[model samples]
Target: MTVQTIPAPAAPLRVTPASPLFLREDEIRRGIELLYFGYTAMIRGADAILEAQGLGRAHHRALYFIARQPGLSVGELIGLLGITKQSLGRVLTELQARALVEQQVGTADRRQRLLRLTKAGAALEARLFGELERSMARAYGEAGQQAVTGFWAVLMGLVPPDDRPRVEALQA
Candidate 1:
């Protein structure tokens, strides 16, 4: 007797409010306001520390991402940060001068520069993350698991369709 294999069923479509359905201006405005406030609140802690170090949000963002992705190429950073080369060059120069970051020529491609954080950079990144974590932890704890999951889905949905894969890859 010969046995045939059965294919698994396809996943069901997920319908969300974020879908391309019509939305009221008032609702959209509310979401925009919430995003503004959330962003401001999240950065406030890190901003204080960065300010004291003569750094700004841009510097902190670079440090945070570099710490997340060690040995990331200069081009990769520019793509991820979505900033102009000039802006990134300025930030990198500052970071290099401070000895917080180091760059090495890629083995495979001599022209490509791989970026890594120094011991000092890691320590500062940890300190910066600590403050932000405290705030997020408190908010997440209050929101509970379900809300947290939904919140992440909403945030991820905000990313452009073309850029979603890149952002999701970073999560991995």
Candidate 2:
């Protein structure tokens, strides 16, 4: 039997350079729309994977952060996610129930709970990240190095000044 191969996607349209009046309302709206749509597209594949596992974006976010810092505390996760304790508690409970995560009492503070991923959790996180990395790599390759740097700068500008340190710490 002959095998069939799907065609590659068409090249993206050429994006116009920003006008001198980039601060105008139309330009700002364009930026906002692009950000919303771009993010939605980027996460679409991961969302499907999460849905198949009976999970949601919040669960994915928790898995990602927990993977990033294996011994992340419950309080620190709440802070990083900027989510309510009740909301996080629900997500963590579900994750633990699925044997995807484990929590241990902090060595220094008996009252504190530190979070870590199970082997299963790590596998799931890696799959999710693979989907994201593929999308990002394609976009970055299309945009090139200079545009990628500018994109990072624009995203950083969106973060509050006080939160910059927390974000910067992740780079280390």
Candidate 3:
């Protein structure tokens, strides 16, 4: 049997402008499709790295947030990740066992556990972030400042108002 290969597109696909009535079904579907495909493409590189290290997206999410806010409490991480305590426990356990993360007792609350990335974890996180940054930077460059701002606005709109503060805190 002969193997067949699909040829890559010769150029990037042209972006279609949203309809004046962006709330139309076609426009809404296009937005959903773009979000899905764009996110998949953006995370593809980081996914490979995670797989090579025997980790998954959950582990990456934990590492990423911990790296962003060292000493983040386990409770806070659970809130941020929107994961069950048991799920977070497993991810944290594996991370600590692999020497990619560490947890310290909270200063004020002895029962609270705070999370931080180990040096190796930081290095790995940086590499993964580098992959994401490159992809986002390229897309942002192509989209220009106004378009990027609009994109951010659209994304922010998708977040529930109650949860916006939690997401905004990441920018701090």
For candidate 1, lDDT tens digit of each residue in 120-148? 99989998998787777766655555666
For model 3, what is the error of residue 122's alpha carbon versus the real structure, in angstroms, after optimal superposition? Answer: 0.3
User: Candidate 1: TM-score?
Assistant: 0.85
- Expressed as tens digits, the lDDT of each residue in 1-172 for candidate 2 is 1212322335543588899999999999999999999999999989889999999999999999999988889999999999999999999999999999999999999899999999999999999998887788778766766787889999999999999999998876
Q: Each candidate's root-mean-square deviation in Å?
A: 10.5, 5.3, 7.6
List the candidates' TM-scores in order.
0.85, 0.90, 0.90
Q: List runs of model 2 lying over 4 Å from the truth.
A: 1-13
- Please give the lDDT score at residue 26 for candidate 1: 65
Residue 33's C-alpha lDDT in candidate 1?
87
Which candidate model has the greater lDDT, 2 or 3?
2
Candidate 3 residue-wise lDDT, 1-172, digit = tens:
1212322244433588777898999999989999999999999989999999999999999999999999999999999999999999999999999999998999999999989999999999998998887788777666665787889999999999999999999999
lDDT of 2: 0.89
lDDT of each: 0.83, 0.89, 0.89
